[model samples]
Target: MRDDIVTIEPDEGLRTWGWVSYLLHLVVAVAAVLPGAQVSIALLVVALVIDLVKKGDAANTWQASHFSWRIRSVVWAGVLYLLTSWLWLLFIIPGWIAWGLISIWFLYRIVKGMMRMNAGLSVETA
Candidate 1:
């Protein structure tokens, strides 16, 4: 039996930034779900740029992972959107299917990442 325990020291700055990142993701999700995809996508891009800029300054693995997760989500969603948009003219149904899948993926990443953040666990990229 292993009796070792792990403890994470709290950092107010990282926690605050983490919450800000998560809230931005939430805004993107809600806006994307409604009729504000354009605005949400622009916001998402801005959020991603901030994540990239600040990731190097993160104090711990947990904080870095959150930024990485957010960046991955934004890039994946953007690529998927662009691909679907380009192909929509040829196959409308497939485009819709791709969009739906992307939305689910986006939501899943944000929810899971936030939950892990709250639990003091690092986000798993894999």
Candidate 2:
């Protein structure tokens, strides 16, 4: 039988992948507000792809929390966007409101993850 246990090493600082994911998400969030910028969404897609590719291997590193956090944030954000997307076809105001709320939530996740990472703490898994 294979052991399912995972050990995370103790290492923290700007040298972690967690920190890089945080910065990428932050840029995507901020770039959304910029005019004529579709690049932000592309960046977000790239970040999510990286998260997917690295998450399994991240289990043995201190960066696991960050990977988990980023993945969850992306999944949640996508769900919210999709669920609220129908509102756009009906009422413009409600759609905008939903988008705004999702944006705030996205920012919150990024900020919270970054703060925890900077403080040498792992992000909350739940």
Candidate 3:
């Protein structure tokens, strides 16, 4: 009756940065989906800084857990955005729909990760 091909381990949880990371994810989602707002790299820098500062000198789970897998994911997001920009120019409607779908998918993953982290922490305290 179940369809999940992969099962997540119980011990792993979201990174320590937690809320800050989720907020940064929101920033990234907004920027990616609303790319027409134009050349504003400041916010992206802000997101990156927030990730680093909020994370502090703590062990890096994201960049190291999968050995830069997150880096590659972020890079792939950039690629998708760039490719979609061209598509947007070609045809406005479908382009935005695709962008919205992709953005939502990314946001869902971030939020799900955060929720699992929160759930684990709660159970630990309980």
Tens digits of per-residue lDDT, candidate 2, 1-126, equal 114435456454323555566778999876554535555477788788778877776675556777888899989989999999999999999998888889788988899888877765667732
Whole-model lDDT, model 3:
0.51
Off by over 4 Å in 3: 1-16, 27-41, 52-73, 120-126
Q: Rank the candidates by lDDT, best first.
A: 1, 2, 3
Per-residue error for 106 in candidate 2, Å, reads: 0.7
Pairs in clash, predicted candidate 3? none
Candidate 3 residue lDDT tens string, 37-125: 44355655565555555433334223222212223345666677777887788899988887787777666655555565555422111
The global C-alpha lDDT for each of the candidates, from Candidate 1 onward, is: 0.75, 0.74, 0.51
Model 1 Cα lDDT, one tens digit per residue, 89-111:
99888887778778878988898
How far is each candidate from the true structure, as Cα RMSD in Å?
A: 4.0, 4.3, 8.0
Task: Please report how far candidate 2 places residue 124 from its true position, in Å.
Answer: 0.5
Instruction: Give the number of the best model, judged by TM-score.
Output: 2
Candidate 1 residue pairs in clash (backbone atoms < 3 Å) = none
